[model samples]
Each structure stands twice: as structure tokens, then as C-alpha cells.
Target: MSNSQQSLGDYGIDIESNPESQDRQDPHTIGILGSADDYAPHSIDREGLPNINGFDWEVQPVQYGPAEILEYWRLDGDFHDGLSHEKIPGSGGIIIRGADDYLREHALTEIEVPDYYTRFENEETHCRWSADGRTHISWRFLKRAVRLSNGYGRIDPVTTRVILCDTGHLFVSGPRGAFLVDIPPGRIFRNGDDLPEPPDSVYETIRGIQVPEENPELRTAFERYFRLLSESPYPSPISHAGFNGADHVLETTSEKTVVNDNNLKVLGGQTKPFEDTVGVYSRQCESTNFVVSVDPMHLPGEIGEEVTLSDDITSFGSSGDTTGIITGYRTNWREEDHIAPSSSGVSTLHFNLIVGLIMPDLTVTRRRINVATFEP
Candidate 1:
């Protein structure tokens, strides 16, 4: 092998088709189309390289207009003895005479996600964000895989891949951890009430979407509500009658409080401990009556900070299409009385919704942080 070439067999990836970035065209990537040509060998120097015809190769251009190149990986090999290569067009069409130079780069190691990269927004086209590249892939890919593969995305760390979760989440060693960056019906909790209809984003009443029908627990867990999603949504089955069903959104019994920081002193009033139902549900809402606490607040008030009922949401019913519980879940973001670092007195209400039956509750927990404000 010349200094420009490597043992292609050593690397398990094939250049003809990149399973990750091949064929599929997203708004950011239209698709990949590469080609190569014959470059006859000349007089051999002791190591059999070039005597002339200087081998050069590039990725053929496909009307991408102009691009701000981020990052790219290259592969090099010969089917028999010809040449192959790829490139980022400065403007358009790629130019390759042989395969030697292409082999000099991009044929090894897995990608560990660079700190900066771009990703397209889930709902909008032509809109991209400059963020930790990992955040972009982590967010959209999961939703994409889940939507495409029957509502779930698989992450295999061993293979450094996040796939749709049909074949048992793929790889034995799942890829890096995945996060829930966003969720649908995002604004519904502002009022804390279940609507007779889901938001337009939800699009329609969910008919029997592709959820599993075998597992008794998972089946019973979904059936009714999802079936109704095919019809319409409801606060409680008894609260209204309609088409399409609803996705599961549960009520939590966690401590939530309204705090304000006029960019100065953190101000908030505290209620008696565990006073969740006093005047929460009936208070006020622009759209809905509740907000969800991913992790409700629980703090040892030595720092003039406390957790109270930010809002109260109840479930409707208990049987058939009606979940029996009146209402559940929320999304209230009143300024924090005080925000702390993850080291001392943190005020974040981490809410975790464990998909369950009857009372899909949002469990709130807090981490001890040491955050404080500054002054002149």
C-alpha cells in the first residue's frame, strides 16, 4: 500500500453506501451522489506510486447552491484496481482523477460528536440551530425514529447509532444516552385542563397507532386512550364525547410553587407542607389550568426557599375510555423564587412521568444546588 492508501478491509465500513448518510434526503442533506474514473499507473518508483497523472478525487455536486461546510468523513478503496474518492464541492461538481488521495483520509475511528454542529428543527423546514451537534441528533433522530418505527427509537452505543426500536433497540451496547428535548401538546398545560381535542400539531384523533398489542400491561396501558385518539381528546371520558383518542398525560402529586426574580430578590409565598389541592386547579389559565412538574420540588428550607402548590390538576374518571382520573400533567414556568446550582439549594422540579395505569403521575424531585443572585 502507498503512503496514501490503507488496508480498506481493516475498517468495517463500506464506501459504496454509508448506512447513516446515504440515499435519504433531508432539508439539510439533499442526498449523496459520488463517482470515480480510471487512472492508469505510471512508471513505478520503488514503492509503486505515481510517475504522473497526479490522482485527485472529489464528491460529485448536486445543486446544493452554497454551503458552510461543517464536517465530513471520507473512505478509500478499489473494487478491482480502478480509483475512488469523495469531497465537499467549493461551489459544485467534484473532480477526481484516481483513488490514491482519497484513501489518505477519513477511513478510521467512530464519530464522537463534535461540540458544535447544526440540526434542522423537527416541524419547520429551512430552520436550523447552532448547538452542541449531539443535541441536534439526539432530539430529532429519536422523534424521527419513534414516529417512523412504531413510536420508539433505539440507541446502540457499541455501534454509535440511534435507530428505530423495532428489533429490540438494536445493539447490545446501546449508543450514548438519549434525552427528551421536547414533547408535543407542549402548551396544553398552561391552563391545566384536558381539551376535547388535541392541538393541531397532534393533527387528528389517534386511531390504533402501531403500539404493541401483545403485552397485557402495555396493551391495557394504551388501548382505550389511544383508541380515542383516533376519535378526539377529552379531559375525562365523562367530560366529553368525541372522535380520536389521547396520548397518556398523567397528574402528579408533587410540590410546585410560583417564584419570581424581578432580576433581583427572589420572592415567593409558601403554603403549608403538602397542600396540593387548596386553590390550585381553579386558579387561572390562559389556555389550560395546569403545568407539569418533571421532578416536583422537595427542598430543606435553610436557604429561604420552599416548594408550594404552583398549580393543582386532577383526573376525571376511572373506567373504560375515561381514565377515571379527571386531569393530569402541567407546564407552568413562573420565575423561580431562587435558582441554585446543582451543588447547593437547587429549585428545579424534575418531573418524571412513568407510563402507567389509572394515575399516570408526574414524580417531582430536586437536586441540591448552590445557585444565588448578584447585586450592585
Candidate 2:
């Protein structure tokens, strides 16, 4: 009998010497078997099966060759594609680029990735995947290194510029341009009181000041001045001089004038010469003399009430202060002869007040004045 026909009495099985029979029985075999002339010495049964245990196997029919088998196992489902340096989300870790490029982009120096392998002494395996395959990387090392390199926990100093606008608006200028923000009006105190309204011209001038990023000092100073103006109720006068590196000077002038009715005649004399002239000219005489017609009803006292013109006349000035007095007064009547027979030929009464003044002897001198009633 051929070797294929051999019988195993212990195992109650027949041995097959044919290669095809051996191949067919390979799936059923689990342990080492006796060597045969057709089988290679290094060859083993179940060569294609998985080495792991407790795996569920499913057999599906296939018409081509041997039945196809599929093996299934449990997986965590957390695996994902590796991330590129630029594709990493969020800010913190240094980007994967040259030092110069990184510095230029972030305005800071390059920071190295953490080396957890060298830092930790534990037996735990820490690794990451690279383009080629799995690689070793310590997240803890990288996080610490990045934190240190980036100054992650420290507070960075920031420079800001504050500007006060004349429109009662407060502007804050920083890395960004001046931002008009609504600031509480009373919150800004100057000289222990609320700030006053700034002139519109001041706003226009400040807006004209060029604040380029290159000149930080000048920009900062401008901002500081703005803040000072906003906070103080009475800030030091701000002018073009301050911006031009000169001392700030304050100039104030009267806004209104007060005039006494008694001074009307005096004002008429001083202003009479200029009534016809177009251009400005100085008076040649020390005192001006002029005649004024007065209404009977406007006279300070009753008719026939003998009163001094100087006592009845009060000086009027633009600043609400009396500046001069009425010097003289008289009354005259002239009769009109009408040729018309229907006319009654009534006489017209004229009351004239003559005003005279001596220079450098005035009791009250005013910077400005207005006359309410005067006719010359």
C-alpha cells in the first residue's frame, strides 16, 4: 500500500499522502504533526489564520476557490488622520517653520516642541504617528515646553492710547486706530469738578495730529493728553503750542458789553466820525464832542424837575459796567410857517443834549460798550 493509505489506529483516522488531501486537512489541524515527504519541514498548518485568540470568525461561500473567512474584533473607533503643523487647530504651540518665519509671523521667538521621552522616567509608552508609521512623542513634554516657550500663563504688557475729542466724545487709540467710545460724562473729573465742553476747534485740531505706528512715544503722549483733558474738568489749556513743543498759553477776552442809557450821547460823539468812513482810523482829539436829540418821554426826570445832566445820566458799557456820564442838555422850540391855508402852523419842540468829555479824567473806562438810544 502507498504511504497515503496508511491508517492511524490510535487516532482512528486515515493518513493522506497526496498534497491536495494535505492541503484540505490543513484547516482542521491544530498542533505539530509527523513530517511527510511532500510537506516542507518549516511549513505549518493554519498559516493564514490570525494569531490572536477569542476572535469571531464568519465563513462565507465563494465559487472561486476556498470558502472566504472574515474575522471581527472590537475597536475603540477613536483613530483619525494625522494632523499637519499648519492644520493643527487653536493657538499655543509653535508653528512648524523656521525661527525667522515664526518670529515674523507671531512677533515672537521660535519655541521647541516638548520631549516627553527624556523627561518622564515611568514605564508607560508614549508615542505618536508620523508620516511613515507610528512614532514616539510625549504630549506632556510638548505641552510643558510650549507653555514655557510661549509664556502661556504670564500676562503680557499692553500699551494703549486715550484721546479726548472736542465733541464730548472719548477716543481710545491703541494698536488699533482711535475708537470713539461712549464714556460717562460725569466720570471725567478735572480740578475736582466735571469737565467742561471742549471747543469744536480743539477736536478738529487733535484729529489732524498724525499718529503713525512708527512714532509710539508721540502717539502715547497725545493719548495721555487726551485722557487728561477728558478726566479733568479744568485741564491745562491745550493749544497748537503744546503740540509744537512750546508752552501752552491761555488768552481770555470779554464776550459781552454793558451800556448805560446816560452814556448814549458820549458814544454817539466817539462813533460819529466813523459812521461815514469805510476803514478803521484812530481819533485825533483827546475828547469827542457831539449833539444828540432826545425824546421827551425818555428823559430820567419829570419836565421842569431841575436835575443835573451828570447825575441823571449813567454810563453804559458792553461788559454791564457804566463807563461815562451825560455832560450837557438843553431844549428848543421852532415854529414852522406853512403856506398851505389848511395847516394850523403848529411849533415843533426840539430837546437836544450836548455830550462832552475830557480824556484821562473819566471816572469809569470800559473795554467795550453799546448805546441803546442815541441820535445825532
Candidate 3:
């Protein structure tokens, strides 16, 4: 996309649109963005999303190669602003690509928010707002192909109407605003008469939004592309969790809720591949782990109901020392409480582990909701 080709003259029904003349601007809109702020609370650029505590990584275009594409779920973030990318796997028999290595190389080796993408990076700054008189902001969760890989890819961005590049630049319209359009140097994102709503997924949970489909003439006819799938969903994250039912063995908090019991009904456990983000040097961590945020996975039992702990405590991650009980040996999606992609047909539980000299022993525990109502 080029800036020379498209101009401010052609914006769409959603997000920002330069109304030709300054007098035509809305009272709340600010045509120009990226200026010094004075009225906002923090000194930061008053971005729409939370503060980005990260370092920019100039993709080692020469030394580092694009991550070997695979068949696993992953989080692809922007090198500039933090944005979550979920996920895919690769070729060459190697399962875990640890795609985030690109970030670690740039010095992002911490895990603040337990997101499937950065389980260390920032939230997707992928949307912007253009309120009249209000300073406009444009943040993009770039779903890009940073590292050129050497293997076969499972998901490649399909050639659509728009000229999809290695990067998926999301054009935002701010809170509950419009998003998802390419923003290259010469490309002018034309808000289609019909934009499509984003399908619900872990990415949606991370971005904290349900992206709507465009009006029509959706994407521009792109000539070339690199990615398997390209998308930009408005984020709507649950920074907290609610607690209900038998409050006997559950710990509740604003961000998350934990329920534990001795008699958890056993479900299933299987081995799955993942790109670990915790290891320091090793490409493989034997006991590496991952944290997942699941939906209404486990069937909540009645208050004071009984459960039977399953034997298999299943867990999956990379090859390295684990510090937490990422998983023991148990079924992932079959149990409640654990994350299950939330997308249709995907029952795999996402993982995030802490690496150390010693493996963080985990127990992928599971239990039935109501033993009293046990059935065959």
C-alpha cells in the first residue's frame, strides 16, 4: 500500500474521514494525530489501549528468518505497537516455532498479561477514534509476516480484493469504532459499504472487541500476499473474573477466579505442540508451560456438589525447565475452567509456562461437575 496513490479525500462510513474542508469537521474531531498531549492523564500518546511497556524490534531481515509456519495456535504482535496474533503451526517436523523469538531478540522477555500471543507483549493498539474536536488516534495490531520461514505454511493469507501485504494494518476508529484495513505508505483505506464482523475467538478476547464485517466492496483487490489468514479484531479483554456457586474451595479475584478440589473427574489428555515464550536460550524446554484463559469450559456443579479427581493430569508446552504446574496429564477442553480456544471446533487448551532450572511440576487436573448427578 502507498500513500501517494490514496488521499484523505476517500475515507469510509466507519472510523475517520477527512471531510474535504476543515469547516466540515465534527466539533469533537481532531484531523491530525501523534501530537504532544496536555489534557490527557498520562504523558504517553494517549493511545486508545493500555500503556505499551515494550521495545521495538527491527525485524532482523537479514539474520533471522520468518518463523517456520506450522499448525499450532500462536500470538503474532506488531514490532512497533503490541497486538495479539493467534495462532498457527509449521513444517519440517518441528512443531513449536516460538515465533516470539523475534520479540525476545528485541528484549521483550517478560510475561505481564497472560495472553496467548505475548504471554510478554503489549495489548493490540489496533483501533483508533476520530471524535470531532477530539485528537484522532490510529493504532494497528499488525498481523504481519515478520520472519521469512523455511517450511510449509498451514495458514496463508488469501488473495482478496485488497492488496494484502506481509502486514495486516488495522485502521481503527477508536472505542467501539471501526477497524481492519491496510495502512501502507500509499494505500488509502476506503471504508467499504459493507464490512464483516470479526468471528469470536481468543484474539477477540485479547483485543476486547467483536469486530463487525464491512458494508460491501469489503477488501481491495490485492495483487500479492504472504500470510495464511489476515484479520484485526477490536479487543475486549476481561481483566477480571466473577465468583459464584459453592464458595467453599474457590478463590475469586477481579481478574481471575480459581476453583480447586481433590475429587476432579478425569476427562482426557493428549500431546499438542506450542511455541514456548519463557525459555532464555534453548529452543526446546522439556517442561516448559503455558497459561490459558478458557470460557465456560467446565460445567459448574451445584453448590456443595461432589466431584472425582481424574488420574491423568495432561500438559503440553516446549522443551525446557518449567517453574509452574502448567499441566500434569489430563484432557484439555473436556474439563471446565481451562481455556478452549472459544472458537468453534477447537477444543485444544492454550498454554503459557515459566522456565527455570527445575521443571515447574504441573497437574492438569479435571473433575466432574456433580457426582450426585453422575451419568453414563
User: Which scores higher on TM-score, 1 or 3?
Assistant: 1
Q: How many backbone clashes does candidate 3 have?
A: 99
Q: TM-score each candidate.
A: 0.16, 0.13, 0.15
Candidates ranked, most accurate by lDDT first? 2, 1, 3
Q: lDDT for every model?
A: 0.22, 0.24, 0.20
TM-score of 3: 0.15
Best by TM-score: 1
State model 1's lDDT: 0.22
Global CA lDDT of candidate 2, please? 0.24
Q: Write the per-residue lDDT of candidate 3 for residues 1-376, one digit (tens) a residue.
A: 1111222233311322222111112212222122211111221122432221221212221122322221212224554455643211111111123223322221101111211222212322112111011111121112221111111222222211111111222211211111122233222334321111111210111133221111111111110000000120111122212111111111112222322111111111211112222122222122433333322223222211222223232122333322221212222212223245773532222222211111111122322122111011
TM-score of 1: 0.16
lDDT of 1 by residue, 1-92 (tens): 01121212332211221122321222122111121112212222223321111122232322111211111123334433554432111111
Lowest lDDT block of 10, candidate 3: 220-229
- Local error of candidate 1 at residue 321 (angstroms): 22
Q: Model 3, residue 24: displacement in angstroms? A: 30
